[model samples]
Target: MMKIRDVGHAIWDRPLGRIVLLLVGGLVIAVTVMLYPPLRDVVQWFLPLGLIIWGGSRVYLYGRNDLLSLISGCLLILGGITRAVFQLIPLNELAGTVANLIPVVAIFSEMFAHHYREQE
Candidate 1:
């Protein structure tokens, strides 16, 4: 006999649930971007909060070996440190955007790695 997984409590056990959550998060970000003025001023306010929540959840779910979570945590740390320094240094905003994207690319790269690892 095969075992069945419980749905109500095992939300993270399935990938679809995760996809839905990601989509919802993206929607929230999109809405915030479209509807809000003073977004740059607010981004630092919300991003750190979001980063903490995201990193904590990922650590809880996947432990330290979760590449995505690890990358995110590193990215948050780097961004925070850079932002603090740049406030005093006044580096190019475009450069900051590009620097921040390193983590985004790392995330996608790791996602692809996970996908291929699963296929093996």
Candidate 2:
């Protein structure tokens, strides 16, 4: 039996295919938001929600890995939480996004530092 992941893999396994898929999906979402009007408010979550899920998994994995990585993952999770909360807390959207990005950028920097430590 072909699983959903296998079907997705078959369809989106190529670089061009992936880009086309993203463009098409985004277009569809854009059209839907244009049609519904109110959906634009709800649709703002696609990214931060994705980050929250990813960060949660990372936090769980890193909890067993090491202290620094666990801390970084916790920070990533916190960033996602703040981004979601900002939606309700009444801040400028661009400013909130930029502020949330700081933790993500710092986490990447820490990851790079970890990579260098491993290399040395």
Candidate 3:
């Protein structure tokens, strides 16, 4: 029988274990979204909005001191606005794709910027 401390040490010691846990969690969420149409729709509409609101709040709180946060937050807010506007308008699929990519690219850019800055 494994002790609680042993289990905690295993989790902390193994990065692969953390990755596996995250993957399993993601799979469960994916399955749930696919099985439930209402949930799928709600996630589709609200997840980006939630990201936008969260990002905007972060910007308001920390943007003054951090340039990367400001840029990322603006990108998130812009992505959300574009997504919402696209939903309202009957536009082409490409526009929708761009709107979706905006936040993802912003996140990646922010991560890269931070990593580069840390190396300096």
Best by lDDT: 3
TM-score winner among the candidates? 3
lDDT of 1 by residue, 32-117 (tens): 87788667567655654454454455456554766655655555555545444544466687877765665465456446545754
Query: Which regions in candidate 2 have their CA more than 4 angstroms from the true location?
Result: 1-7, 66-72, 89-100, 103-120
Candidate 3: which stretches are off by over 4 Å? 1-13, 113-120
Looking at model 1, which ten-residue stretch has the lowest summed lDDT?
Answer: 1-10
Candidate 1 residue runs with Cα over 4 Å from true position: 1-9, 48-78, 83-120
Candidates 2 and 3, the one with greater TM-score: 3
Ranked by lDDT, the better of candidates 2 and 3 is 3
How far in Å is the alpha carbon of 62 misplaced in model 2? 3.9
Candidate 2: deviation at residue 23, Å?
A: 0.6
Report the C-alpha lDDT of model 3 over 1-120, residue by residue, as the tens digit. 999989978986899988887898889988999888678777777856876896787588768977877887787788778777776787788987887788788677567656755776
Candidate 1 positional error at 48, Å = 5.5
TM-scores for every predicted model: 0.39, 0.62, 0.68
Model 2: weakest 10-residue lDDT segment is 109-118
